[model samples]
Target: MKGRSILLDHVGEREAAALMVDGKLEDLLIDDDSQPRPGAIFRAICDRPLKGQGGMMLRLPEGETAFLRQSKGLRPGQPMLVQVTGYTEAGKAVPVTDRVLFKSRYAIVTPGKPGVNVSRSIDDEEDRARISAIGHAVMEGIEHGLILRSSCAGADDDDIAEDIAAMADLASAVLNDLEGTEPEALTEGDGPHVLAWREWVSAAEVVTDEGCFEDHGVMDQIEALKSPFIDLGEGHMYVEATRALVAVDVNTGGDTSPAAALKANLAASRMLPRALRLRGLGGQLAVDFAPISKAHRKQVEQSLRASFRNDAIETSLVGWTTMGLFELQRKRERLPLAAILRGL
Candidate 1:
């Protein structure tokens, strides 16, 4: 199908389940596909008159502080190598250390605003030759004196071209739409997952003989759904939040023995941190395991340590509280997926 239908349920014990897939609840619309959106970041010369800098400015594909340098090294008007120092503020491009700083804002290219912005109204020749190589580009913005990620290796001229084209196309569409219709439009490009999977590889070492796929992403997703408990039946538990000032409550559901239940809780604890990372939850966590013996507490602690073997985020367990709480903390810079799910 050209599109996927996602159903999210947040009303009852049955949290989320997909009923209809493509365009039907059964097997309809399973063969069609849609085109992917073109995404890019451009790098080009800035030839704009800055408010206080000078006659020429350097702009990056995404930053603001353009590296301002004396115009004495290269061609007067052409594209060259640059770096992404920092983003622009009100009206400036900030560059980093070791730069060819110049007095100019990066003029983000597009199909509409194709040329380098020289002033409030002036523009220079479009770097069409270099930009056309990309499939379809979009110029996000023009910024102050700075270089962009385009200077990095693997960011070919094709990316620049694609970015320019995308921006141009969007601008044209906006103008056309505005002249005859609505003024507000939302357009989003590819995101982090696309970038992360750019160089992903996988292999299968062990699997059931019945039906196993060669690609690991499939198993990985399935494993993600299963609870870490080795023999807890097919029922799986999903958690929300990555790191936060939160607490975990335990219930055996039907387990009877106190120590066994405690051991099960310990097993569950071992999996909690992993879920936190997967859900992108961060901050403080106070987990209360089922009341068990001190030995089981030790086991839980050890399991907690084991689960964090490959975490990129920093975490610390302050040991259990006198009241039987597992105190821990995870630092973060953004809201985790757990929060997103809960909020939804």
Candidate 2:
């Protein structure tokens, strides 16, 4: 409860993983069996170009269609490898990209982008040099790009090299199967347990027992997320998801001090990333902070930026609107938690 803990368990029949920091739920991952998950590699056939949208539709296995935004050189009936980028909204084609990547815990192999680099987070020159040498050694003849993740810092040399080699091998095998005429699935995306192991690389206690979610209060936290309200001690925030966007409203609870508005706004900013992460909410987000003076807008913006800086999801702080609201655009990388657990 005091430190970080990784809980691997199940939510109903679905596999789930939870990351808890200081006894608070920091992140959540739950398997959704309804769609083609992000990171799935496929050999797709170009169907037709949406000239109006400047995109092409790809035919995947099981009669599913994917939408690729970059369709400049692609023609109908051409075969290409694509990766599912994110969840598809209802009645929309799955979003995909031709740039496929093979990712693991310690390394990521980027196909068509040839280079060997280490994570910048490894600030130590010696560590970076050592990791770089390992990567270059393993990928000497490989044309695919190699990126040594931050987890390689201070890691065993043998382990890092093995990881790099494994990912490189996977990329090579997948890239070589581009001659197929029909659409096919090359690999599935990482599941909840595997994702937790890959992304939550910092030192932490690992709990893999059955029903660990219940044992660690993760289920309760998830249940609370079903509601729109979130308590921030002195104030509260409401996070509700609409078909168009996520709406957040901040309010100072019975606090009439001069700085109460700013205080509540800052609190909302700090807790917003984690809240959205747990809920698996993305796309457009509009935050209506408690009415603060223009002088405090910059401070609130800084707070929001800092909070989302380290989040794994890509989020763009689109800045304040003409009205008194802040906006964000986030990648829809995962299915909504509420939708995933609706009847379970």
Candidate 3:
């Protein structure tokens, strides 16, 4: 509530910085220097690898390299291990491998725990193989993973062995500074806003809720809300949060055909515009559909305004309402993906 900004006054004791959404204030007020950051993380020089471009053309330390696109738990000649994960409105520094360290500590396991402990200060054998990789991410509940060195968050076991012998002596001086040629590190991380504040400063997630599938025409009571915890795929939908102000009715979740209501309204309008950029749903929002067949309402509002054409937000659709509602207006910026994974 009460946030959204974009001002830019004349020097000195600020004149504005207001731009709030969901609790409304917006219209963009930018007065500059709210502290700019988007760089830092060293080493990068090893280009040459674009033959058929599956990947490999690095040469960064200052300029090029940035190709790295191998999704679904990335991989390519192993030993990669990235972690930055954010910072690229143009200022680079956006790594993110080791499958985001096993999905950012995936709801930190606690089920009758027998394992899942991390302590360090350097002892050896790669700090006992990073504490046997956090005891195999607490008995393989690691649908994700990452363990480089963090001075052991809240140390104990002899202050995590003096921080795992100082990261096994900086991994033995990064293996004696890569012993003469061929290196491509950039591990300086923590930007995508301080790595979205250590992934939303923890402490939350108590309750939740469902989905299903069965080829073409479904409904065994909707294929019994398919599970692995909800994934109503036709295209995709995973909006874990936005808190409020996101109103998307788009019926056809009962479906028929304007084409299977523009394919379940184009798989939930591209999964509600990427669940409104990962559920950060800002102020005035609306997306009510499921009537469009008056000979296909302007071809489904021109295919939902060409699927909000690569939205940067600042949307508008005002076209149907004699009870066919299709009004639209999305304009929230910053902190979304469900309030930076709800650490807002």
Candidate 4:
């Protein structure tokens, strides 16, 4: 991809960041830059607690139960470390383990759970092995996981080790400050578009213009969520997102031939994911493709996965339901664009 630009509009009551890929607006990030983001470690007091299969649901002093796998030993009124994961659809708190993980340009240092993990982006087998070994060596005796980022591919292990050590000292300083501070954010995650910009357009120009949406082409890139139909050249897609799930239907626009219909369905399989991501839609999503033979199902699934491969968030393409709709789930971070824009 060519170099892009970022526009940050913060003049309004809410702040929004727009990412332009190759001079075209691609993603919108709505976040309050004045406040701290998620990933901050906090000393939270537990309220109510319940154990679930996946994790424990413990209400914290911040007024939301944290979804954590290691909440087994936590009890009510106890001060424990917690990290803000993100927000839910209803603006509820979602907290994770207090394990402070700091992401540098080259690596991620996890100071809470000591271990070694390599990023999935590094595909080379030998490189993966070498980075993992280096992580293990550097993280020895530390209660944290050292993740070798893809940027560390050609990096020297000694340099990476030094970076890890430096980050360890930073984490220690933050922890030491917790001795006096109450429940509050110690660090913040980057804005959604900021992360997207770093991963997709590293050298992109950044500008802040509160009036750029109507003046520039920023509005063109955002998905008009209220409009259910999305034009896809060969065909158009009708998308409906309820509180429970998101449903999308593919239909041929003008040409009704079987070949044309198949082409449209294939196009929908590829385009829908991008549309959803642009709209920042997440949670359960189901796509109803134009009818195709059972033999073609595998091909459609492959196309869908390939289309979603570029997304930063984790997306799982679950198999078709009994009614033939394809099921998938995307990890939700913040509210969708529609809600944020409409002040919902």
Q: What global local distance difference test value does model 4 have?
A: 0.69
**Tell me, what's the RMSD of every candidate?**
17.0, 1.0, 21.3, 4.1
Q: For residues 242-283, could you state the per-residue lDDT of candidate 4 as single tens digits?
A: 989988889887887878767887889878766776676788
Q: What is the lDDT of candidate 2?
A: 0.92
Per-residue lDDT for 198 in model 3? 30
When summed lDDT is taken over every stretch of 10 residues in candidate 1, the lowest stretch is: 27-36
Judge candidate 4 at residue 320 and give its lDDT.
87
Q: For candidate 2, write residues 1-344 as lDDT tens digits.
A: 78999999999999989999998999999998788889999999999999889999999999989999978999999999999999967788999998898999999999888899889999999999999999999999989998889999889999998988999899989988999789999998899999998999999999999988887899889999999999998699999999999999999999999989999999999999999999999999999999988999999999999999989999999999989899999999988888998847
RMSD of 1: 17.0
TM-score of each model, in listed order: 0.36, 0.98, 0.26, 0.79
* lDDT tens readout by residue for model 3, 1-344: 22322222211232212222432322212122222222222233334444564554333433433444443333333233233333233344333222222212112222222344443544566555655554463345322222433343433444444333443344334433433233355344323322332333223221111111111112221122221122335322333322454556554554454466666555566545545543335455655555446776667677667767855455676676677766666654433322222221
TM-score of 3: 0.26
The reply for model 3, stretches above 4 Å from the true place, is 1-43, 47-50, 54-271, 279-303, 306-310, 313-344
| Model 4 quality (TM-score) | 0.79
Model 2 CA deviation exceeding 4 Å by range = none
| lDDT per residue (tens digit) for residues 1-344 in model 1 | 22333322222221222222233221100110111112212233554534454334654343432444544443434454333332222244433222322211122333322334222211223433233223222334532221222221234565444444444454444334322111121232232222222211121122223222212123234234334232332122334333225556655655566456665676676667555644445567777666677777787788788776555457887788888888887654223432333443
C-alpha lDDT values of all predictions: 0.40, 0.92, 0.39, 0.69
Clashes of 4: 4
**Candidate maximizing lDDT:** 2
